[model samples]
Target: MKAAVLFETGKPLQVVDGVQIPELLQGQVLVDVHYSGLCHSQLAEVRGHRGEDRWVPHLLGHEAVGTVSAVGAGVSKVATGDKVVLGWIKGEGQDVPGARYPLVKDGKEYLLNSGGVTTFSEQTIASENRLVKLPDGMPDKLAVLLGCALPTGMGLVFNEAKLLPDALESQGKSIAVFGLGGVGLSALIAAYTTQPKVLIAIDVEAHKLELAKKLGATHTIDLSTENWQEALQAICPGGVDYSFEAGGKAETIEMAFEAVRDAGGQCIFASHPKEGEMIRLEPHAFHRGKSIRGSWGGGSQPDRDIPLFVELYKAGKLPNLELLLSHEYSLDEINQALDDLEARKITRALIKIAGE
Candidate 1:
């Protein structure tokens, strides 16, 4: 199998044309990847930020969608030829972060269990249960994205924050999204479905705000320009009912603390900030009934939430995420893809790989 292998940290990933397609073990499924999204985590691996679980001369993709070509013993959730999206999870009590994150390297295991996936190759292995089958005829590329970004983004709104159905008083309240990338925008789209009167989309880029408007955001603020707290207060007329930190920056999280209304509102931190980092907040941010919650992989219980996004997309409530796809590159072109993404040249970057 061909894969983009990072033989060393802080070095270019080599498009190794002949890496082994890892054999599936019991309870695993083999997928022929059709598409993979270049996640920030992959970039972190190349930059050596993940420290542990950095596989050198190893496949480095996780966001993917593919068709099942085979299943190993004990696998029953899916079958050969089933179109499915991939998910990466370190099962609870795994090599998760604490004072330290565990490490494995050089063609070795990186999980508490071997079933966690690595999706950056032509054929990959995943836990059978984590693969969500796409209904026949769904757009492969779009469904593939819902496999990751859409679910993570919208799930945070639906499951993590659990926004109430009613907007004002209950129905027309305010919600702020702190980043405008795939996940943030997807959250905005999900928040829009709840009909929030004030959906504040924040980003450093003006173009992202434009897309936010097109996608049903009630207002957009450039976080790079002025003080987000003042801008948010000016719009919400006080503090917001909900503020989400999807950017995973300590600074952005601080803004979330300031944007959320005290006493009855909540701030949801949707992504893990840098390792060993902490956000300093006034004790009062939570004293007046303010709640803080962390959203992990959008609180996805894969079977329940992944397909709902597909249904929502089929009904046209969700933006065709392919619209967010700014560039497509081959495995060899990954470095360039990251460059395009980091430079804000691509709104949602994806790389094409073969499944068929």
Candidate 2:
């Protein structure tokens, strides 16, 4: 099968021919990848920025939607020909929240499941337990996103921050989403469902801020200006009740804390760090009852959250297509997709592995 192979650090991806197909081992499944997304993690890997360039020879897909071609003898969650959405962190066994993935290497547990899916190839292998079956008729384009971006957004609000639907009306609190790309927009859409009292979004680009408004942000803050912090202060005078930093930068994560109300709000970090980079925190501010939490893949438990997003989208109540921005390229053109992602060109780029 064909796959994008990252040969070295700070370099473009080199396409390799006849990359061997991995096996359907214990708790694993083989998928004929239909669509794979270009996510930040893959870009970080291509640049060797994530310090995980070691998984180089492996495939480069994290968010993908495809059909089951076969499964290991013991698999039971899904069957051949079934449609599934592959999360970036695919692994075997039931991956309940708080379950420790045993694929820990060099001290850190590989946040992504070992035997689960990596979708960059024409065909891929995933742990059956890690894949989520979409209800029939969910468009492949939409299903592809639920695997990564959707959960990262929804899980942050509903899981990590625990934004209960019932709280929006009673609390009548405002929220801020500090990034307007894929994950940030996902946060906006999820926040829309709860109908927060006010939804403010921050982004360096004015166009994305405009897009955020269409996606449900009641207001937009342009962070490029010197007084952008004042803009943030203006809308959220008492500070927002909840803040999410989708940009994944230490500076933005720090800003979330600065934007939240005292003792009543929480800020969440949704982006993954490339290396061991650390973000500074205000210890004194945190002591005032403001909480900061680091979230992984939006704290998703696939079985429960995946279907929920799909069902909600199907009802036309959730914004799926609007939240996801997909630009498809063939397996050979994977480099172009990565380049576009690097340039911040595509919100969520998808690769057409096979079967249009």
Against the true structure, what is each candidate's TM-score? 0.88, 0.89
Model 1, which residues run further than 4 Å from truth? 52-54, 89-115, 164-170
Tens-digit per-residue lDDT, 312-350, candidate 2: 777876754644665778888888988887777777787
Report the Cα lDDT for residue 79, model 2: 89
TM-score of 2: 0.89
Which regions of candidate 2 are displaced past 4 Å?
90-115, 165-171
